[model samples]
Target chain A: MSESNLMMHHYLAKYLRQERMPHIWCEGCGNGILLNCFLQAINELNVDLNKIVVVSGIGCIGRVSGYINVDSFHTTHGRAIAFATGVKLANPELEVVVISGDGDLFAIGGNHFIHAARRNVDIKVICANNFNYGMTGGQYGPTTPLDAWTTTTPYGNIEHPFNLAHLAAAAGAVYVARWTSLHVRRLKASIIKALQKEGFSFIEMISPCPEIFDRYNKMGTAVDVMKWFRLVSQVRHGCDPAKAEITENEILVGEFVDIEKPSYGRLLREMTSRVQDKLKREES
Target chain B: MVDESRAVLTGTHFMSGDLACAEGALAAGCQFFGGYPITPATEISERMSRRLVEVGGVFVQMEDEIGSIAAVIGASYAGKKAMTATSGPGFSLMQENIGLAVMTETPLVIVNIMRGGPSTGQPTMPGQQDVMQARWGSHGDYEIIALAPSSVQEMFNLTIECFNLAETYRVPVILLADEIIGHMWERVKIPPAEEINVVSRKKPKTPTAEYQPFKPDKDLVPPMACFGEGYRFHATGLTHDEKGAPETVSAEVQTELVKRLADKIRKNAEKIVKAQRVMLEDADVAVIAYGIPSRAALSAVREARKKGIKAGLLRLVTIWPFPQELVSDVAKQVKAIVVPEMNYGQLVREVERAAKTTPVILLSKLGEEPHRPSEIIEAMRRAVK
Candidate 1:
């Protein structure tokens, strides 16, 4: 399909709320691309639509949940993971995923993010790291690189940004990966893997915020950002996520962590059955 | 359905108020408890940790109170009856998410074991300070049902009522138990599971294709659709339309939605509000009180009657919808209304408003102990004068 035709009449249109279309995302914003990738992954897996739930917190990407044609929840700021934790544990039969932005996941909601990953809750989390708070007019956030310019940081940000891949792996997520919007096919592949993973899975998508982040940082435009990602991105599978960092010159992107452990829901179910059995034995 | 043998603890047993509250929740078919431990309220978390496991339910010790309430709302959305227990400090942390629960019309219960506090004032003592906070702590205009349990037995009974009210109205109900009631051990009769009244949230009877998650019925509460039920509906904290879609810029949508949220409880106040009026028929003065302080008010009323003072007691079982008519009725029949509260004064302000022209004297106590019967009797004497 031609690029224009693909953009105009995507096959995944059925997965979106058509009535709510002509989405409010900015013309050059990467949220639409990231959401398209997510829906593509969901479609490829052919997972029961009724069995999947999308949860998001406040941010530009937070609106992703509302646009999706599924049982979705747009929760309070920075609480998507915590809310998804409840949903997954209550009904382990349902597949829960949280799609939110860097600020909403790591700044205001940083504690919940680390704890949910630590518990290895059976939920998938996809963080759209546009380096700044795009929804709120480009404020520098936890993922914004040191010395990066943003609306809030007119003089450039002095605070160190978080290496999200390192943080997720350190917090005990069973699967961790990173891909830019330029790597759409690869990102969708990683998402499919993350969705099927048994424990807390995290994917950090280095998205483009051309209208704000690019404008403030003198990074040209949305097309320029994609070209920059293609030139500087390195594919390294099974590398130490701690060593994988996004610097001004280069961005390391690939699957960083993949291992297995019993998820919180599975552990909880096991413990409950054990306790119930013991009680039954005592009564018998 | 509850596992009667495991969850009901059906025989009469001596237990603390917090333990009884946990049992009441289990009997009410509360399958999920997400909580953070705090003083006075910790026993509820500890007890549920054990009981929920035995009953094959989920009990999670969340990282913080904010997460605890957030998880409770999530679990409730997934078709589980869910609750969280915390004290003053933790309850303060939960206010924002409580507002989210209100906006989404999620059914869940929050058990706030009252402690003295503007911020962490007293953790190990009793105070009715959060009664006002429970009604207004969350930001924005909304109404909630809050119950004050005076005794250990009421702690059990009222927790169940909190769940019922929560499910009935699709709102977060607060069981405002104080430190004294939570810690005290007393005889609590446990009825069989079959005898206990449990109400679940109304589920959408409409087909998945036609269901609008926020479309309200005549009672002004929309039927809920759980996540995996094929409804494929959306829920948001923003001011939303009947389709559960955000309408942030629409004043018409905001007014219609917020008004319905408040009026559901206001319109149904008669069914939700509960109070115990003691010898109020021929009273010259009335003592309006709730929670642990109401015990002293009861004793004071009895002593006042013996001393030939026609004083009566109006013990507030439900605090949020503030039994305005009941207080107004008593105020008209009485010379004055005396309000004894653990904090300097919280609910007294409500009584003052309710008792329009009648003088309402405030007997404010601070720190550990509640007002003594003698102290309340003195207030009653002043009221009569």
Candidate 2:
């Protein structure tokens, strides 16, 4: 939106793309931009890209692993979080990042995400919420806005879109934030903070899928779709659940939550030593 | 669960496939086992958890089969010979990550003591439905070295072989066992330490700086560096170049990656493939069998000898890499081949393919119950006549 933000976006895109895959995501898809923001965050944070593992589930956004030049994994649908958690717990030294689409993370693997966050695993999850199934022919998903027309829900969406940031915060995610693709700089900062935080951190990027979601919803252009994102979203920080409303053309996106706690890796080590101590006492 | 007696001892006793698998992992120098309990294979997780700790190793019960394999792969990447065991259902859950190991060329052992399935078909019962799935379970074209052991000893030896093959090749090896072997207890001897040849994955013999995780070496299997190791190499499930970074998902990368993956096993198939032949020096008919059915076939052949039918036996010690050429050559000399299996005509196709001029017959039973020696005898007599 600003000249500085455009330069920031341009700078972020430099080191993110693989030569073979200049662009695998559909045109007007925010996945590439989201990936750019992630790269900028990790780059700005000065992480060892060698030790940084960008894990993704199977989807358009999941292909982020394929483009990122890291020790990444393009895992099976909904299992990236589980795999990333294993990778994190296995070494505890590697910086693991799970970049998954809303459908990839929420619908099938929502349980794993919650449990992992609850345990405070030292990993950052950057979830791209396009509010519809952008891949697989624009089907209605868990994050599909209420009353949105989709291939599966032709008449209207009957299900409520999950307020993912709120849920992550509630589930013991030490740091949590939500931002639209429009605010790439803020999202980048949020990701950097989440990556730096030594516990379970979650960031939801309300991305636009102009080709699929926009066409299906009869929204004409990317600009209009972004406008809808701005209008529908309540900029309510400490955004109370009781005040949450379901209005057509309304969506919520901003830095929703942030905090800190002992990471799962830390607690696990503690548990291991405690057991070892107990065994020693009994033996003595 | 703590076998305070330690792993360095000679033992002969009845045990299921799971316990035998655990001991095999231990003897193979596996110090880490991460898995979850799934039927026909729960004993493996339980035993591995207990034994790994006693051996000053690590056993982590991950949340699911996916996590189980993930943890083991991570541990393997951490410079440990690691493993995880599960059954058909869990194996189904593991297919995706199995592909991850395939693409990453991660060295680990997975014991698939198969039960019936498309999904949760027969958790406790025995089945060989995973025969086709084991080879092509992961969505890719690569050579998977799966070994099927007929007896408890096969389970023990095959488990060790699985690890050795995995480490030597830097690829995941499957101990394709069954519920019967997994649950049955039989005498087994832990191999003497002096005789046991443990192969850790080939570390970079060159300067660590020149190491590429997915690059083919002289043997086609590239030396892999552990995670904590200073060598900086990236691993991805995506179609990767020699350096283990994601390359284009095109025909070229696919061709190169798939060829390398398949070639690694194909090049070493001779060294990896194992099987057994009995009474084939002068025989008219042969009993082609593996797994529990082979046990029956062994008995049937002994009875056929008493009857003077010239019925020999060809037992497939390695279920995968199929022992086809050997079977085919052996089959040409015989009049007919009797294939008695637990599943309905699963291995019969292989026998028929192997036996060109000879009659290739099938005696199959699809039941919760296993095959009887008499059933195989009846088939053998029919073939001989």
Top candidate (TM-score): 1
DockQ numbers for every candidate? 0.76, 0.27
The regions of model 2 sitting more than 4 angstroms off are A1-21, A25-29, A169-172, A215-235, A240-263, A274-284, B1-14, B31-34, B53-67, B70-80, B117-119, B192-194, B205-212, B226-240, B243-249
lDDT string for model 2 (B1-385, tens) is: 2233355545666776678878888888887787888898999889876566666566777778877787677667766788888888889888888888888899899988888766878888888777777788888688888888888887888888899899999889888888998999888877577677777788887676577777778889888887655564556677878876666657898898889898988877788778788888788888888788788888888888898888888888776766778788778888888887767667677667777777888776665887787877777777777
**Would you list the C-alpha lDDT of every candidate in the order shown?**
0.91, 0.78
**Candidate 2 lDDT over residue span A1-284, tens digit each:** 77545644765544453343556687777887798788788778888766777778877888777666566666667877777776776677788889999998998778778878887888889998887777798999988887899999989999988878768877888877777887788889888888778999898888778889888888767778667767776666556533443346555555666666888778666655665556668878
What does candidate 1's lDDT look like per residue over A1-284, in tens digits?
96555644878877887767668888777788889889999999998999999999998888888899999999999988889999999999999999999999999899999999999999999988999988788899998899888888888899999999999999999999999999999999999999988999999999888888888889999999999999999999999999998997889999999999999888888777777778779978
Error in Å for residue B5 of model 1: 4.2
| Cα distance off (Å), candidate 2, residue B374 | 3.3
Count of clashing residue pairs in every prediction:
0, 8
Clashes of 1: 0
TM-score of 1: 0.98
Error of 2 at B94 (Å): 3.2
